[model samples]
Target: MDKERLPRWGWLLAGLFVAALVANLLNLFVLVPTVFPEEYRAVTVITTMSPVLIYVGVWYDEHRQHYWEQSGAHIAGDVLFVVTGAALGSAIVLVAIIDFGIPAFLREVLAMGAGFLMSWGLFWWRNPDVYADESAR
Candidate 1:
C-alpha cells in the first residue's frame, strides 16, 4: 500500500525498528570499537545507546507524525525493542572481552540476526490491525 494508507502506528513501529537496527549496528561495530577498544568504556557505549535510540525514535515519531497518540503500551514496546538491541550489542562485546569467544564474523551476524528477530516479534505482537479490530469489536 501507499504511504498514506499505511497504519499510523504500524509506520511508527517500522520507523523505530529501522532506526534501532541501523544505530545499534553502526555504533557497535564501527563507531564504538573503532573509537574505544574493548574495555568497560566500550560496553558503556553499547548499554547507553539503547535509551538514546528509544528517545531518538520517539522524537522522530513525533516529528514524523507516524503513530497515533502515544500510548503506554507503545512506550513499553519501544523500551523492550531498545533493550533487545542493546543486549545483542553487549553479547558481542562479551564475546570479545572473553578472549574472542565468538569469532569476529559471527559477532556481526549475531547482532543483525538478533535485531531482526526482536523487531519482527515486537511489530507482530503489536500490529495495528489487531488493535483496530479489537477496538471495533
Candidate 2:
C-alpha cells in the first residue's frame, strides 16, 4: 500500500515557504521596477492569492482521497478573503506611517508581509486539528 507522502501539516508549511519565496522573487525581479508605485499591487495580490493556490500540486495522488476530502479549500478561501481585510488594515496604518516619512517601498513591503503573516498565523491558530494525519481520519 502507498503511504502518505507527507504529514498533513507539512503541506501548509510547504505552501507557506513557496508563497514567500515566490513573492520575494517577484519583488527582486519583476515587481520592483513596475509602473505601479512601490510594488503595491504586486505585494497585495501575492498576499491575497497564495492561499487559494497553495494546494495546486497535492492533488496528484488518487490513493489519498481522504486527505483531499477535507474542507481545506473552503478554509483557504476564507483565509484568502481575510487577506483583503488585512491589506486594508495594514494600508491604513501604513498611510499614517507615511505621514511620518517612511519610504513608500519599505511601507508596501511591510504591509504585505504583515498581512500574509496574519493570515497564515490565523490559519494555523484556528485550525489545529485540520491537518491531522490521514491516520487520524
Candidate 3:
C-alpha cells in the first residue's frame, strides 16, 4: 500500500499536543478558563466521544472498503492525542489544586473537559479530510 494513502495519526497527535500546549499556556498566562465552566460536562461528553467516533468510522470504512484504511490510523492518532491532552490537563489541574484549592466539583469537571476539548478540537482540525470522508459515507 502506498504510505501516503494511510491515515496520518501522527498529524493528529501532533496537532492535539500543540493545541493542549497553546490552550494551557493561554490559560496560565491569561488567568482565565479557556472553556465555559458551566459547559464543562458537555465538553467532557464531546471529548469522550472522540474514540467512539473514530472507531465507528474505522469499522465502517473497513467493512465497506474490505481493508482497513484511515479509520485505524485515525483511532491510533486519537489515542495519542487523548493521552497528550490528559497529561497536560493533569498538570494544569495540579497547579489549580495547589494554587487555588480544589475547585467545586462542577468546576473541576469543566476544567478537565476543557483540556479534553482542546485536544479533540485539534484532532478534528488536523484530520478534517478523514472526518469529512467518514461523514459522507
Candidate 4:
C-alpha cells in the first residue's frame, strides 16, 4: 500500500460519490429541470447516497482484504461520522440557499456538493481504514 494513493475501494467510493454529485448538479444547474421532472426526488436520493457508498466501499474493502479490524462500535462510528457530517453540511447549506432565494439548480449543487465533500472529509479524517498508508493525502 502506498501512502500517496487511496485504496482501490476508496477510489471506487470516491468515483461513485463524484458521479452522483455531478449528476445532481448537472441536472438542475446545467440542464433544464423541467426536462427531467417537476419533483427533485431523484436529486434528493442522490444527495443522500454519499455516506452509504463510502461506508459500503470501506466496509467491503476491510471485509475482503482485511486491511484493518473495524467492527461493531467502529462501524457505528464510521456511520455516525460520515452520515452526520454530510447531513449537517447539506442541511446548513440548503437552508442558507433557500433563505437567500438562490436559483434552484445552484441550490441543489451547493447543498449536495457540500454533503459529498463533508462525507469524504469526515471519512478520510476520522477513519484510516480506507487509506493505504497512514500518511495518506
**Highest TM-score model number:** 4
Candidates ranked by lDDT: 4, 2, 1, 3
lDDT of 3 by residue, 54-84 (tens): 4334443544343345577765776778656
Q: In angstroms, give how far residue 29 of model 3 lies from its true place.
A: 35
Q: Give the higher-TM-score candidate: 1 or 3.
A: 3
Query: Residue 52 error for model 3, in Å?
Result: 4.8
Tens digits of lDDT, candidate 2, 84-120: 5456555565655666667777776677666656655
TM-score of 2: 0.45
* Span of ten consecutive residues with least summed lDDT in model 3: 38-47
Alpha-carbon TM-score of each model against the true structure: 0.37, 0.45, 0.40, 0.55
Runs in model 3 with CA error above 4 Å?
1-68, 71-74, 102-104, 131-137
Model 4 spans with C-alpha error above 4 angstroms: 1-47, 59-64, 133-137
Query: Candidate 3 has which clashing residue pairs, if any?
Result: none
lDDT of 1 by residue, 11-36 (tens): 66665566557756766777677875
Distance (Å) between predicted and true CA of 74, model 3? 5.4
Clashes of each: 0, 0, 0, 0
**Candidate 1 wrongly placed segments (more than 4 Å):** 1-41, 61-63, 101-137
Error of 2 at 36 (Å): 12
Q: Which of 2 and 4 is the better model by lDDT?
A: 4
After the best TM-score superposition of candidate 2, give how far the Cα of residue 127 lies from its true spot, in angstroms. 1.9
What is the Å distance of residue 117 in model 2 from its true position?
0.9
